[model samples]
Target chain A: MWGVATGPLRRRAVAQNLSTTLGCPVLLLLAQGYDRPSYVDVALVLALLGPIGTLVFARLLAEDLDEDPPRAQALTWAAAGFAAAVVLAVCVATEPGRAMVKLLVTGALLIGGNLVASRALARGMPTAEERHG
Target chain B: MDDALIAVALLLVAATATAAVATRDPVHQALVLSLLGVALALLFTVLQAPDVALSQLAVGSALTPLLLLLSVRKVWRRRQRQGRTE
Candidate 1:
């Protein structure tokens, strides 16, 4: 979060995207550790909504970001993998059931949204010549 | 284990909240606030309040940042307009 708050526009977008990708699994682990299935809904919501939030930033700040967009392909993939591993582990622990389905859904959404946000942030910015011309 | 989980979540909440406050730029602040929102939601979940966590996730993750960034954009645009007019 601080990473997002104290950097250039590119870095801030990257940090915001990364946090969304990463926060979902932490929420999942919290749900599993607490033995509260309902709590998983929080993870679900975050997974679904976090990227939308980043997209909000990207769209709202498009002109500012068009100067030098940020990219985090590696970080985004790593975060997605982490989310997959956590969701899988929680699924294994909880066994096959409706809850397991929900966990898988959350993981998918988290990874998908992370990728989308990362791609958006990584879009090429206008070069100086392009901006001036 | 429960105490440990709760402690960790609380610690994260504290750290992220501090980072959010310490940030200077409005854009950066918006980004940090989103992270803070996630941290707070996690804390709520750990403390056995999913309802609170759910609302926190909704408001903190998207709405707050959206409002902040939108307002920032607006202010900048207004300033740009004034500069152009002048």
Candidate 2:
């Protein structure tokens, strides 16, 4: 969090994306450790919205990051995979049922959104014409 | 075990909140604030209030940052226009 708050724009954005991705596992852990299935819903909503917040930064700060974009492919993959593994382990513990299905959905959304957000952060937006006009 | 987890979450929220306030830049503060929101939501969940966590995640993680960034962009644009006019 400090990294995101103190670094330059590029590092700040990357750190923001990384924070959202990493949040998935912590949410899952909280759900499991507390023995509350409803807690997973919070994780689900977070997974869905974290990327949207990153996209907001990417769109708004396009000019600032145009000179030098940040790319951390390995880190991005690691975070996504961590979310997947944690979700899978929990699903196994949960067994096959409605709750497991929800877990699977959350896992997919978390990884997919994480990938999309990191990719957007790495690849600067196209020219204004293509994006807006 | 859950006690330890809750303690860690409380620490994370505290640290992230401190970082958010410590940062000078509005943009960086927004980023840290977003993360702090997540940590706060997790803390709420650990405390057995997923409903509140859900609302926090909705507002803190995405909406707050979106609003802050949009306003920041608008202010920057206004400043640039003013500079050009001057």
Candidate 3:
């Protein structure tokens, strides 16, 4: 059997995925008006990956699993909530088409990265016996 | 801009924070943090700043919780083992 892996990388991936999904879009939308390219990149890297960075540190402090999937399910709901919020955003969005496009791309990256990272963490978590024995 | 969805999203903010604080379990608290994360994402939207909202959505709501959960799970297992060993 494969050993359960734990460390900063997976945790980083999780936080990166989470913040990217939830925070990056807002920053991206704001950055769109700016002429400087640096703003956009910084926004993307920081806001998008901030949560992942936080998670990496957090993972080091705690354990990796429990029998409950309620938390996991709640995460899914949060994702849906984010999507619903986006829809609300679009409904209220000002005309010009550019913001919409930016919003869509940002949403895709955040949600996509998040899904991939979560799966990786799930697969990598080690059992208790593996940890102690 | 059905106002209702916006209101719902606004309402979620309190829910998320409450969830985060209401738990004794670190894992559950982490999960609730994600809800707060989504609420933060929604706040970005309402503020007309989708860029911030997008990043928050990607990282805060999704990744943070999972990582925290992963860590919390590990800690939980460790505690359980200690309990068993004792």
Candidate 4:
């Protein structure tokens, strides 16, 4: 299914997925919306954090942006290892049923793949002119 | 696979996402990215997460875009100072 979609479409899907999934946390704020006049303000905080988080990540990975040999390989392997560990741990857990396990695993893979792909694309991006205007 | 709404929701998300990525101007990108956020909020509604939809609408759709536009303008100013078009 993913093979057919263009690159940016895939990336957008990833972004949307991340926002919606991570947004699960926003549910807690719903109960407090009445008492807290600033529930919306809380949501704003998370949204701002997402992009800021991305920028910080970009900064952290700046050294590897120039296509360093060893570091790039290490980063990829590290991401892969993290993904593997999460999925493996979930599979080993006794609580979730098969259906829930499947859903969890798929969600994890989607998020992991998105992060890895976005980082790669960001690194490979040409100058802002080439990327934007 | 269930309702037509889901398909339409997905398409909207796709369009907004495309806009965000395809635009060349950073200001334009910010606008498109904002649209993506709005569309994402709508998607949350389709997914039956009303709380999420509301929060996304408030934050991602509205505030984040404003901030991004402001930041983009600032970046533009800095670029003009540095004599760079991008």
Question: Best candidate per TM-score, number?
Answer: 2
Ranking by lDDT: 2, 1, 3, 4
Tell me the interface RMSD of every candidate, in Å: 1.4, 1.1, 9.1, 11.1
C-alpha positional error of residue A23 in candidate 4 after TM-score superposition, expressed in Å: 20
Winning model by lDDT: 2
Candidate achieving higher lDDT, 3 or 4:
3
Quote the positional error of residue B75 for candidate 1 in Å. Answer: 1.6
Q: Each model's TM-score, in the order given?
A: 0.90, 0.93, 0.44, 0.37
The runs of at least 3 residues in candidate 4 whose Cα sits more than 4 Å from the true structure, single-residue gaps closed, are A1-133, B82-86
Candidate 4, A20-127: lDDT as tens digits = 324423322331323332233333343444444334323333434345411234444443455455434433443467534443544354345445544543554455
Best by DockQ: 2
By lDDT, is 1 or 4 better?
1
Candidate 2 vs candidate 4: the lDDT winner is 2
Over the stretch A13-53, how does candidate 2's per-residue lDDT look in tens digits?
88888888898778887788767787788888988999999
What TM-score does chain B alone reach in each candidate, compared with the true chain B? 0.96, 0.95, 0.70, 0.77
- Per-prediction backbone clash count: 1, 0, 57, 2
Per-residue lDDT tens digits of candidate 1, residues B1-86?
Answer: 77897898899889888887788888878888888888888788878898998999899888998889878878998999999999
CAPRI verdict on model 4? incorrect
Worst 10 residues of 4 chain A by lDDT: A1-10
* Candidate 3 lDDT by residue in tens digits, B1-86: 44765676677676656655655666445544654665676565565565776677567644666666667668877999999999
Model 2 residue A130 CA deviation in Å: 8.5
Residue-level lDDT for B41 in candidate 3? 64
